[model samples]
Target: MALGGILEVVALFIPWVTFTLGSQTASVTFLDAFSKMTSGMDSFAAMYVRFLAFILIAGTLLSTLPWTLGALRTKRSAYWFSGIRRRELTPPNFWWYRTVFAGRATVMLLFHIAGIIAMFYEDLSKIGLGAYLLLLGGVLVIVGAAIGPKLTAAR
Candidate 1:
């Protein structure tokens, strides 16, 4: 989960869409994806893709926070957490928090649907590297969430 969250955040900076016009190629990320949706007067489906992208980012961050915070409390730098103790921060079992992860997975799935819509909706536009990274980030997050419980249990 932690890895997924980190990856997702990093992927935002990558190029998701590439537009080449008049010999100039511009690459865009999630940040630009939202604006792209607003440029045209009748791009409601594009809006859905833009919205889903934000939801994916939010869901991953929220779902991964507990794990990341717990790790922070234990990596020999509990002092860095100021007043929070390791035991107080780390949950013994992560699967108990399945609802949060489930929410993230749901959003990721929605994001996938939105991505498909965007692909067909903007068939002429060239997809960029960032879009691929975003897809990967979503997959990683889901995979990490699934394996997280086993990892904690193994520990």
Candidate 2:
């Protein structure tokens, strides 16, 4: 799950699509694609795309936070939070984490699926590594969240 979240974040900076025009080829990251694609569009369409991008970014970060916090709290040197006491930083149990992760993952997955569908409307661009990574990351988180509790309980 942690890996998935990290991958999703990393995917933003890598190429998501590649465009080939006869003899020339160009690859663009998520931000690059967003800027280039929206630059010439009408306000309504641009706004819609912006909204989806915002949701996708925000959802990925939000969903990843709990797992990160939980991981941090488990470390021996995790007392890096300036003034906050150590006890206050302790995370909830596996079930709580699993539930929160699953819920957020589901929402992120929906937006990601929507984004994938939106990509089909574009012309002459091949989906790139970053997009596939994003999809894989979302799936990993969802699957991890769903089965994590059972696996932990079995041990």
Candidate 3:
């Protein structure tokens, strides 16, 4: 999850949109598109890509924290944060939480799917290196998330 999120974020720096006319070609990255927003130019696609960038970061944090922290505990333990206080935790180890990474990948909660959809719908011809990386990285994340749990349990 951490690696995937990092790659997704890095994808922002690579060329995602391309344009061509005659013998000339130009390309832009997510950051480039995003910066355009405050420069008197804004597009729905850029804003949506910006949102997906944030989701990737947040999702990485959520998934990594539990896995890293859970391993240090002597036994399964969780300290929940909520309004006021809770009398007790349902259990030390929660299975539902384990599904978060998988869910994010499967549904593409990080917004890679949306990015892909938006790209294909808006301008297929303009897709470039970064867009291809985004699609490939997204698929890797999904496959890794799906297999990671099973691999851990088997050993």
Candidate 4:
């Protein structure tokens, strides 16, 4: 999951699309393409893309940071909101944690798929490395989320 998050972040800076004219070629990174492409669009579509992008980034960071840190520190997956009340810090319920992670992964994956389809609807071949990386990263996150519970239980 952490690796997937890191990959997704890296992909933002990589070329997502390349345009070639008679003698000139220009490549656009994910960030550039997103901003430029959305600028000329209808308000509704632009808003939706922006919202999805926000969720993708937030979900990746939120899941990755805690999972990476928890694994490194205690070799266990971190539980969200695990003991905010009182002085003692109690571990969260395993089933609840797993459910949350799975649901979050599902949402993220769906958003990624939607974004990919929207961007490449006109020309599938125009899709580039960054887009592929984004898809792979989302898949990895889902795989990690699925296996996280079992790994935690085994430990």
Each candidate structure's TM-score, on Cα atoms with residue i matched to residue i, is 0.59, 0.62, 0.62, 0.71
lDDT of predicted model 4: 0.64
Residue lDDT tens for model 2, 74-149: 4443334212233433334445555555777788787776676566556424678887888888887887665443
What tens-digit string does per-residue lDDT give for candidate 3 at 11-121? 779987777778999788877876765544345455565565567646654554344334323232433321113222233323443444456655654465565566468
Candidate 2 deviates by what RMSD?
6.8
Mind giving the per-residue lDDT tens digits that candidate 1 earns over 1-155? 66656666776677766777999987777666666565464454565555756665886666555544444435344334222332332455344344445556657656665764556464635656665666666776666655444334554
Error of 1 at 17 (Å): 1.7
Report lDDT (CA) for all predictions: 0.57, 0.63, 0.55, 0.64
After TM-score superposition, the amount by which residue 93's alpha carbon in candidate 3 deviates from its true location, in angstroms, is 8.7
Q: Could you tell which candidate, 2 or 3, scores higher by lDDT?
A: 2
lDDT of 4 by residue, 1-155 (tens): 77777677787888888998999999998778567664557643365455666667676667644543444233232323322122222244444544556567778778777777776788889988987887787777766765553334543
Stretches of candidate 4 off by over 4 Å are 37-40, 43-45, 48-51, 64-96, 149-155
Q: Rank the candidates by TM-score, best first.
A: 4, 2, 3, 1
Pairs with backbone N, CA or C atoms under 3 Å apart (clashes), candidate 3: none
Q: Candidate 3: where is the Cα deviation over 4 Å?
A: 1-3, 38-46, 64-98, 149-155
